[model samples]
Target: MLTNGLEKRTLSDVDVRDAFFDELYRLAVEDRNVIFMTADMGAFSLERFKRDFPKQYFNVGVAEQNMVSVAAGLALAGKKVFIYSIVPFVTLRCLEQIKIDLCGMNLPVTVVGIGAGVMYGGDGPTHHALHDIAVMRALPGMTIYNPSDALLTQASVRLAYEQAGPVYIRLEKGCLPVLYEDAGGGFQQGFTQLRAGKDISIMATGLMVHHAVTAKDILSRVGLSVGIFDIYRLKPLNEQALLEVMIHSPRVVSLEENSRIGGLGTALSELCADAGCRVPLMRMAWPDGHCREACGREEIHRHYRMDARSVAERILDWVRNT
Candidate 1:
């Protein structure tokens, strides 16, 4: 939703890109050392940065690898740099640059990648960022953020700028409803419990958070008040706290748009193993493969049996038949 001063706006009114730049612009205003550079990606609020804060805006054409290297140099020069690009381009394409230039020195450069998961569902697998989380989490000292709403995106900007290491912010496009009333100090914990339930808990991140909340309501019709945990911060997850939440439920499901291999599911799985928790865990994520069929996210989700209905039905079967 479009934010006007402090007045609350509906969730549908804010675009992730616009909310991001809007918040970063505020930071740039206060700190002239803050800069934004991109690899010729989409221009949501870029024009504003160019027109009003020209000195802090940079457009590095289509050379993504070079852009990361440049941002590393800027960081070395005592500047807080943010490189905006599509998911694959910013991380996968320039993995070496990010690893050697930014991560090598633990620079304070924030890489903002748009189109989290299948946000560009119609754009085919080439645009899908199914492996982005796994790729990013592997970078040494890199912090990953997958925001579920505009409020978190704004908070993420501040957190990324304030932190000392390289940070990656994953975002989804389109009109997503607001999931947070306000992002306060607790955001630093890296996760939030949306609701509590006795039977099962759906630990979701990014856009799937909406599906989790909807699935919670859907399950309620069948007399199940499912728990919800939004794990926005992927890496450096608060494992002990998350385990505390999971131990209360008989089953826990890690929900996300990325692949189950090395995404949220895998992370949670590792946590359970290390903590010696025996609660049953299920992974709800994009199937490990590519789809050529051009479609919207909901349609693709339905085709893959990953929609809200599927999520509810699956949990229903687990709760009733298991």
Candidate 2:
């Protein structure tokens, strides 16, 4: 039961990338066995890593597949390895390496992919990782996390470092809206309910968490009580929490920045069926396709009908009809 009353802070306010590197530096300092690998993209942050811990840093120079394989090999030798790169290049380009070398072998490698979803909005379709979730979720024994803000991002990085297994962490490009102030020291690797309501449940992830929060406010102004769930861990979802929320609300709306297929909606639907819960489910996400050109994040969201206004309208329509 997390409440959202803290002042909204942008990603820049928290130095998310620095926090990630700071944790890595701390871990590497303590554990001489830890190693960091990158596909030549972490120039600014990796500099400190290279200077402070030169022996533990490896720059793979654009070869994401080779980087992942090397990290897998290192992890197999009891070395805590982390692979960093942009979202598309890291996830899609190295899909085979990730699936075979890391996930298939059950290696404890932390694969950090920046610019998840449309975070690289103006960078065009080539850079947008619209299908990264679908791809990463298909891998077995892989832990997937999409942190809502800098705080959660730092927490996820720390957890990935501590946990043993192949982990995929999707990070937004820059600063995002801070939705949670104190997750009570830290949040667990599962969904956290941000707001509680009996009429509707809004299950959201990634950047959409902010939108869900905004939508909740808008819906509430209209005398609608909406429950909000921040789905931190995509795989190994908090089934019990989800079931309880759905059972209590009777109407669930899943919001995500990725496609409807194989994303939050798919997971929630499966959870409902598995729990034998009957509810009217609505999915708010990108359509079952790709975009043509580059656009701003807000424009893309509105074009796809995933903006706060659109979500609010959808929920209002559903409530009225019901």
Candidate 3:
């Protein structure tokens, strides 16, 4: 079955991690100045990097803070450094180092965070990165990029390497559905509207983009035209594009896997208020507290009411009430 004329795919069907690793390896091969560092994770992937460029790969066992600092040091010495680790361990655990060492120095270091936003669903709260966006977005000069699928993840890796500054990219453990067949649709450092509509606008980021697209389809089938925007860059938000969309639709909904506070919803709300555009705004996200148990990704998603069905029902209810 298809929702909103958009078909669904799973990570097992796509090769996101491999695609990202391949791109990283390609860059390392060409540029001797490129270095890969992982905090005891990504053994198989780092093995490939070490096999090709042994001198350029470093496995700093379980030291995310030290890893970020070391990457910043290397970047200062004119080296393109990429640090890879699990989301919570790398982003939250090393927040101070990321801010002080990387962002403070304005170094070109790419910190790749895996298991973003409960991708490691069965791993429990310690592993889930529900607040990485809010934490990373608060850091000055840090570019936060969240790719919806493997293709965009690869493109984001390439862009992070080329962009000058501290870049934080959130990646899943494996492949996700290919939202865009090619990156030629302009996956810039801002939000991009994936589908256009006239009734409501759905702003989403990370894995939620897939669900947002699904929700769009569900609404469209009921004769409700909805627009969907993939928020790739969260920190330096594309204010103009977001405002234009809000103005066009007048009703807006933001869907994210992270907490409602200080996430896409918060950012969009602020943007709308600043632009003096008042419309019906809704947010579908995790509540302010932490989840207690370790469960499957889909189970957790349903528990938080973040699935496509819940999103569609909520939007439809909102439309009906409004």
Provide the lDDT at 70 for model 1: 94
Q: Please give, for residues 116-230, the per-residue lDDT of candidate 2 as tens digits.
A: 6777777778878778887888889888999887767777777888777899988764556666666465677488888888888899998888889899899989999888899
Ranking by lDDT: 1, 3, 2
Please list the C-alpha lDDT of all candidates, in the order they appear. Answer: 0.87, 0.81, 0.84
Lowest-lDDT window of 10 residues in candidate 1?
1-10
Candidate 1's TM-score reads 0.96
Best by lDDT: 1
Clash totals for all candidate models: 4, 1, 1
Better of 2 and 3 by lDDT: 3
TM-score of each: 0.96, 0.92, 0.93
Off by more than 4 A, model 2: 1-12, 183-185
After superposition of all CA atoms, the RMSD between model 1 and the true structure is: 1.8
Steric clash pairs (candidate 2): 11-175
Stretches > 4 Å off in candidate 1: 1-6
Candidate 1 residue lDDT tens string, 141-163: 99999998878887889889998
